[model samples]
Target: MTTVSVPSQSRLLNRELSSVEFYARVLELAEDDGLPLLERVKFAAIFAQFLDEFFMIRVAGLLELDEADLGVRSADGLTPAQALGAIRERIGQLLTRQAKLWKRGLRPALSDAGLDVATLEECSDKEREKLAKYFEREIFPILTPLAVGPGQPFPYVSGLSMSLGVIASDPASDEERFARVKVPEGLDRFVPVGKRLVPLEAVISHFLPMLFTGMEITERALFRVTRDADFEVSDDADDLLEAVESELRRRRFGDVVRLELSSSASQAMHARLVDGLGVKANQVYEVEGLLDQADLSQLVAHHRPELKHEQWAPVVPPRWARVKTAGGVFDEIRRGDLLVHQPYQSYRASFEAFAQAASRDPDVIAIKTTVYRTSDESALVSSLIECAEEGKQSVCLVELKARFDERRNIEWSRAMEQAGVHVVHGFPDLKIHAKMTLVVRREADGLRRYVHIGTGNYNASTARLYEDMGLFTADEEIAADVADLFNYVTGFGRPQQFRKLLVAPFTMRDRLVEEIRRVADAAAEGRHARIRLKLNALVDPTVIDELYAASAAGVPIEIQARSICMLRPGVKKLSETIRVTSIVGRFLEHSRVYWFESGDESCVFLGSADLMPRNLDRRIE
Candidate 1:
């Protein structure tokens, strides 16, 4: 067998691209005549939302890393300062592209479709009159203008809040003054005055003069700020829950990582804002169109299905109604193995069925599950509450530090605790990442355990958008392994061996490495060997190195990663046999699937794991 080596410079993908360039390309692709108009609008909206999350998490994380003086370099070989600089440069370009998309591409296409996002200047006389009345009745009551002067300090700017900075002169004294008014979240981001929709910032900017009757309005511009939202938990904290709550409080007061001002902002005003927010000039972004594009999601609900992808209703599993009517989902599991593909198949039918079964089954002795992110109206949580009400043994390991969902998880934790559900925060350090549900039942032979393992969260709402996979099995070995995993999470037991399951923080990574080595050895022996991995990210250096080694030994590797792939594919002498591609479309690729060709035999494993360092090294079962 001939082994091939990949050259370093032959890598296919860059470590990171300018977000501005990335989005500009997205807009460019969206405007292609080959794509549908509605699809283009959806792409535009998605690009905006992606930018919001990038600011919230990635930018926030980088700021925190710099503040803590961690001095850790990213996989792309850039320091925090360099990363921020690159991000700023990229965002400026993206903002320009966003303006172009709105002003040229989407606006015209929307007009053709009879849906226009009109500005105050573009409104007709009758429309203006209607807007005036609507503003007086609806928007005026919610306005709170904060004056920045000697007696007042800068107001606390909430994360992602769009506000207007008004420069006004007193009619009597002719002294310049600045006032800020945040667009209220309770109000719609897009105010529909007549048939046309207007941005709330535009509406507020137009009516600023009316609010200050005695003042001469000189200038006004829209601005927004992104704050550090990443939470850090102390290892020695007395109570994890209390520590998380305190951290959540501090998240609001975190150092500002970004300040987005209108391009027309005066130099003095920009300097004042930079000083007030304690951010550098490079951190400032001048947006032309909407300050926050995430709010464009509101326009997605304009009852214009023609402006978006066709609605996709999830398919009900064949056994769903049968299991639900049988008063227990475990009965079906006991009879046969079940497979579920999300978005195409419903998560409510699978997860809700587990909870519903646990709540009603008298023979079921215990129920245990791990929860990371759930909606405000979670069917899974509701079922758990029902189990507690029914006096069934229900234990939930709710991870309070699930990033953006911390506050919601805290509220859920309190609610679960109040409902008599034994809610534990899992290990103090490790996050419980494995998605599993254990149901202990009294069987004819003895105690039997049924388990459900999945590649995604137990959340029903996200199932419609995120593509994932789940397996329901009553196999004693796998069920026993799941029981051991639950015990390891909630108690002090660690299984020394697993028959069919791969768990992190123990043997998952090692097992994967071993499997890759086996394929490499077989390839070296002139047998066919291949590996396919589909994941959200690929950042673990160890895993990347192993894959590279396998590639050197003639093993073909195919990877489909949705975002943030550290490993560069198609590099000569390094990863010549490896190919990586990302698919972003109607459904978010969330499943982590690994398929290995073992010459004469093949194996597949699906679970809640990504090839990230934190997931492999720090997270628990």
Candidate 2:
């Protein structure tokens, strides 16, 4: 077993200071005048989304640790209990920044942009009458009001779902009452109030009297709950698919980790919710604006082109265009290997075109690919269905547990099956993270295999928005390895060694470790050595320690991680030679590129794997 050495306690920074200070710095940057106005709003939205996920996954995970009676200490020497306490304190401060942005920043800027988010008090009498009529016609029918009292139990609050809390008094008994009304998911999070936008919660609050009829309505507030959404599968399961299905079913019932309430919630109402949800007082958060700002993404799509960034269509490489124009897409592949950089270069011209060609070609024997994500109107999926309908073999290994994409993958798998395509739900315990496609063609000479290896998903929609790399090769060895990988995903045929491919859950992690060691050895021998890694995240402690060791040995390291990097850069002696920078722009930086320099021998590898424990050790290739 390869084990990474844990650094001494003295090396760890103060947990509260490290996490809280970084959050404060992010808030400072968000409020900085140097950034563009719209970009500042974007940053605020990004921070809110980030915090939402943190509550959903990280906070939930820590709560699970507490539930399991796990006493493991984090790298920073904080126990689960201590970590939760620290997170609550830090998150509270972060929420304060978010509230300030909404009140002091976004509201003013939005007003300047001629878009006003009106509160109930800000509405005219005619506008209020219009809202009341709209609420009665559309919203009243969808709401389910649940009373909490001696006869009624506390209602179950679904994860991230918003609700209106009503405080009413029974006209007969003069007893104080509490009732919860869940805002219908079908309704838009923000409804148009005349020319401006008003959050659905605010709209619902205005019509609370309609729901609780004959009761003296005293007060009303909005609240939401966020539960643990992470799915875990048992390793010893006899049937992987069954285990995954079961876990997916249970994900809805996970413990609540966060309860977001209106800042003006009464003390009685807060206490009742905290007890009802079985959540700690510290897990509760108070916000002045909308509970879930993720819905703001809808507002961002105003069709007002001038308010948004300029759209840039991905360019089609000359070679690809020539193939498409010449009516011979395969000729381009036959000539030589083609490399594509997505967003900058078109993915449909290459990957989607290959699938379409396979579907139309009579001599094509089989088409196989692993799908992690796809759009609703996926051209690649349509082509695969066409292949099946044309009496050609079409195999798809669909990962059903591709976070937040499970439902879509399930639907796609069913559609593929109905189309006579071989649909394989991947192993329950291990997610197949490889992005590959294989096509077998019967040619005049013999059989030929064309393969595509990408550093991102096959989803054309994401391809246009995510920075990724894809390689189209007719190389026999690479094609054979891809065949092996596909077979391994669809069946039980595991290849022990791969030619020109490093597969995770087998050799990828070991290969990375060995490469780092080689660089370290070269540095020790007075030879030039360096490593550059660009990834979306870096959380696996083994990789982090390896980079730390490399840094200690004087090997320069540059890392570009978009989110959740565990390694602390610029630490004296510990990581002095390591530099890290993250870039967030129009395109999501999704490609993972690893480059090493050992005495002028430069090597580069791109793949779909991140340096995370699940990707490295648990997920299948």
Candidate 3:
């Protein structure tokens, strides 16, 4: 056996901080000089969008815990307040780096490429006159100004919406009042004026005088609000769709979690805005550039495709391509389990086409699938609807609790129901995050089941961006397990046991723990022991502890986690035998693969479950 160094501490890393670190790594990609100019801008936009979600969900949750006096401690042992403080500090640093990258790197590169984000002062007379006429004719009609005074109430600020806060004084009487002008979300963030582009906020600020005709604009500043958009549905809720709709309606009025303002804002202006919103001083952020850097997506979307990374179309995997020659889709899968890696391989040509064929096949009688998140152009849904119209039985477990996707799922569920597909809105409390599809077909011998399991959503658009894998198998045991799993989800009937697959909220955690201990037992017996895992996150304390124990027993462990790793490796006497690496690249690493070896026995399993507690014990994945 080989010797492995052990870390001194027996503790997990902070999950919140680990998540922040992941975003920082993305920002590092944005800062990479080797990347194409526009590709770097895209990374910056992704980083900003990631941070927005972090605040809206993670940070807001922590604040809520602190306020509720729950004294919740993370798997890494940080109190809610401690975690919040650390998050704010790290976020401040990242915000500075993001601002610097835009100001010093992308902005200059863009200008050099003749795609400048110019200001009002930078525009020439002709451009300025054109913009003035454009603004008056197009933007002015939709503008609504709300005032704050003795009689007027403070206007409601919607979450993530950009706005201009103004302090205007009556020219003759010197009477000052505060008001707000919301930047329409529908308009482009950057308006083009001839060769240059202008920030929407800058245009609105320059024309603030026009909006407040007789008032002297004393102070004007760009600002944005981030609110707690996370909500829960009671397990006993009678109607899941209505519950989600109600929460969506209430999301806009959620407590303000973050307030971002321009760095140039006067102290008086900042203080007034802060007080009016009832946000604490710690929640305020003064940004040096655009209020919402996510809008940089517009800059990335510029038509300068030459400055961006070369686009590559996906190729159909040869195995899938050979299906026609082999007889049919069923014959191809029956030959052996077929695997296709996404982005590098086209999902539409393979997995989606499989469903389409299944729907049309005369032999196929029943189709059952789990729907988490899919796009409007989803051929899977279309196929399922078509199957129903053809008098074939079809069932779709559309998870309405898939965060940020509840509305679309609801709409799809209703549409599927109208088309005669039995649509089951998933459990009220347990979200079904699994990616699965089963098709039962009639054959000369008997009824045969074909199943497709994947590590990503059924969304065709994301399939082009996310690195994932899908398996087409006709194995009897796995097929039976999938059938039972679908039955459990749709009929509230749980299986007594699984033959090959490790399921979540039941046996996944325990089985994983058992496998780790098996490796440790093998190591203790003076045999080779090893484990490998790749996942989007690793935060379950129980699983981490088992890995720590396995490390102490001299088992070699390697993890390639894309985000939120709580286990701290490389420390003495704790986790030295373990190694962790995160990959941030053009395609998102979203698949989860696990491998374990001990003595003569070895096993490999792939599924949708992450090592996170929510995935293991709470969700129905």
**Winner by lDDT:** 3
Question: Deviation in angstroms for 429 in model 3?
Answer: 1.3
Q: What tens digits encode model 1's per-residue C-alpha lDDT throughout 1-621? A: 233344433322233453334455556656665666767776777787677667777787777777688778765567777777777777676677778777788777777787777899999988888888888899999899988899888888888788888888997998888888888889888777666888777877888888888899888878898887776788888899999999999988877878889888888778777876688877788877656766666766677765566788778898876764423577788889899999898777777767777777777777888899888656778777877887778899999888788888999899999999999997667887888888888877888888889988878778888999999889999998887777767777555688788888888899998888888888988898999999987877678888888888888999987776778777777888999887766687899999999689787888899988789888864
What is the Cα-based lDDT of residue 600 in candidate 2? 74
* RMSD for each of the candidates: 2.7, 2.9, 2.1
Question: Candidate 2, clashing residue pairs?
Answer: none
Question: Which wins on lDDT, candidate 1 or candidate 2?
Answer: 2
Q: Is candidate 1 or candidate 2 better by TM-score?
A: 2
Q: Is candidate 1 or candidate 3 better by lDDT?
A: 3
Give a tens-digit lDDT track for model 3, residues 1-621: 233343423487888899999999999999998999988888998998998899899989988898998766776678888988998999999999988998899888889988888899999999999889888987888889999999899999999999999999997999999899999999998999998989988888888778999888988988999999899998899998899999999988999999999999999999889999999998998999867878888888777879887887999988777766312888888889988899899999888888898788888899899899999988999999999999999999999988889888889999999999999987887899899999998999999999999889999989999999899999999899899998888785656698877888889999998998999999989898899999999989788878888888888999999988989887777787999999989999999999999998998888899999899988876
Against the correct fold, how does model 3 do in TM-score? 0.97
Q: Specify the poorest-scoring 10-residue window by lDDT in model 1.
A: 6-15
Candidate with maximal TM-score: 3
TM-scores for every predicted model: 0.93, 0.93, 0.97
Residue runs of model 3 more than 4 Å from their true location after superposition: 1-10, 325-327
| Range of the 10 consecutive residues with the lowest summed lDDT in candidate 3 | 1-10
Superposed on all Cα atoms, model 2 deviates from the true structure by an RMSD in Å of 2.9
* Global Cα lDDT for candidate 2: 0.80
